[model samples]
Target: MIRAAAKNHKDVLVVVDSQDYPRLLEFLQGNQDDQEFRMMLAWKAFQHSGLYDCAVSEWLWKQPTVGGEYPLSFAVPLSLKSSLRYGENPHQTAAVYVDKRLSEVNAGGIASAIQHHGKEMSFNNYLDADAAWNCVRDFNNPTCVIVKHTNPCGVASRDDIIEAYRLAVKADPVSAFLGYTASTIVDPVGGVGGIWLIWDPTQVSVSAHIANSQLIQATVKRENFKEWVLAAVYASPNPGIRQNLWNDLENTSSLMVRPWLIAGTILPIS
Candidate 1:
């Protein structure tokens, strides 16, 4: 109706119920002319087109509703969990939500993943699954990725998923069991309260140790993080000291370090 009025180069009056007139008037307000009317019509048309295309089309894998709220329906109620990391930084909050109906239907009525069992999910768990599950989906062989925050602490692929899980867990066992295993300094003994282990049934362990674990997150995504292992550590020494040492090393590129420097290096020393 708005388009028709705009095309005729006339004032567009959208008359609905008296109660809706206030809402309608809120949509259009400006010093008016045919040009302005046409522009308004075009903008409205574009928005409507985008809504139908992105929000209502068959290609929409995820749905976004008005006011950013996904309505809960009997057919598709959502299950949610809060994440450990805030947004992209240490302070920003985040969470994950899945449609319980779709999950149950797709997984053959098996509620294999129970998020309420123990520890809450974290941003890194979602991120880790984003990296690991895709890898699990791609190959007949099993694969695993230990992620610290969004980066891979350790990743490996093996015929047996359990072996892969062992390799992933061993990468930085002290940190691996914690939420941000590779990035955070987890208490060596105390913080092992809950560790989320996401895996297929073949890789699932039933031992008391595995049962005592805090959380085990499991999912399937294509193209896993089996080969993208981050180095053991990402810390850098003082830049000035490092640069000077680098310059000295470059000048004596072939020089071998004495036993003292090597011996002085901490292994047993902190």
Candidate 2:
């Protein structure tokens, strides 16, 4: 992520996915209203430039550890993705930025995720989410990963998806307060589980959310559950992700079936 050449002004229109060509054309034809889509495109345009600028800085940072002198001035330009209520504390200010390079190469990850439902994510939320996302991807079987404060509170991979999730939380029920869950098994088959039956990973889940304290539990509803075989049940920890309880789940859940993308949520220590 290197220059602000792709920056978007107030009057500009930006679209990255070619699949949106039909939608863009339709929007131009005045067939519908997509104010939210317009805003998101403008945001992506700025991120394009931010990625370029950050690319330059990323190169500079690498030099120091590679026997080269550090740059006289150093800076990283990241496009703001979301703003946290606070940083590590209430008095501090913090926000999350999208990695333009990562977005360009692959548009699925914690940073570029689509939030199905959740409260405003905190900085620590991002950290723990990142941890959970990576841990689940580490397996190729029906798996579940539970994370707390950026640590692997629990992780299990089993032939049975429900059992996997149960074992993960049971690994540390006290710390099993999951804000999100993930896995990478394609053709992830399923039988009757506790709440629902999920037979295929490709079908769209009819989410019948059972919202907990701060999270909306995933309870996929279908007129014919046996036919669709699509189900997803999300859960969360105590109450601030331990306080907020249930929050943030879409990223890892949506990414579960996308096999092309193996791993990308390695947040920088800085």
Best by TM-score: 2
lDDT of each: 0.43, 0.55
lDDT of 1 by residue, 154-222 (tens): 777898888998887877665575423221121111122223333233433222111111111122232
lDDT by residue for model 2 (1-270), tens: 112323433345677657778877888899666767777666666665656676777675677565355556655555678888567755578998875657788754787877787557767777888888888887899888887778897899999999998888888877653322332111111211122222223443434233333222343433555322122332222222332321234444554442221211211222
- TM-score of candidate 1 against the unseen true structure: 0.31
The global Cα lDDT (0 to 1) of model 2 is: 0.55
lDDT of 1: 0.43
What RMSD, rounded to one decimal, does every model reach? 18.0, 17.1
Residue 177, candidate 1: how far off, in angstroms? 6.4
Q: Lowest-lDDT window of 10 residues in candidate 2?
A: 184-193
